[model samples]
Target: MSPPTAPSWSLVPDDLLTEFLSLLPVKSLLRFKC
Candidate 1:
């Protein structure tokens, strides 16, 4: 039998996720698809 997979980070709360991402540089943010 296979082991269980880990949960995805995409499940993070919007407000918290945005707040954390905001701390990153603008250039770095642009690198992500958003």
Candidate 2:
């Protein structure tokens, strides 16, 4: 059997995603950047 896959970010609306990302602190964003 195959393992479950992660949900795709493509399913999220671009504007909503941008807004969410903007709300994150710079430290948190830096962690994700790596």
Candidate 3:
């Protein structure tokens, strides 16, 4: 049997991701990006 695979966040929709990111403060988001 094959090994179990890890779940990926890539499966999340771009719009959903954008919404979450938009909820963060500009400074916090900038720090996270870096």
Candidate 4:
């Protein structure tokens, strides 16, 4: 049996997500595809 799939690190914490994204490099952030 396969394990359940988990959300990726791209799924950062709400506040932290925004904070992280705000600080992410343009190239790396572009890979997020919004």
Q: Which stretches of candidate 4 lie over 4 Å from their true place?
A: 1-6, 9-11, 25-34
Off by over 4 Å in 3: 1-7, 26-34
lDDT of each: 0.72, 0.79, 0.75, 0.72
Model 1 spans with C-alpha error above 4 angstroms: 1-7, 26-34
C-alpha lDDT (0 to 100) for residue 29 of candidate 1 = 70
Q: RMSD for all candidates, in order, please.
A: 7.4, 7.4, 6.3, 7.9
Better-scoring candidate (TM-score), 2 or 3: 2
- Per lDDT, the best of the predicted structures is 2
Clashes of 4: 0
Best-fitting candidate, measured by TM-score?
2
Writing each residue's lDDT as its tens digit, candidate 1 over 1-34 gives: 6754745655778898888778777758778856
Q: Residues 1-34, candidate 3, lDDT per residue (tens digit)?
A: 6754734556778898898778777769789899
lDDT of 2 by residue, 4-33 (tens): 474577678999999888877776978999
Checking candidate 3 for backbone clashes, the offending pairs are none
lDDT score of model 4? 0.72
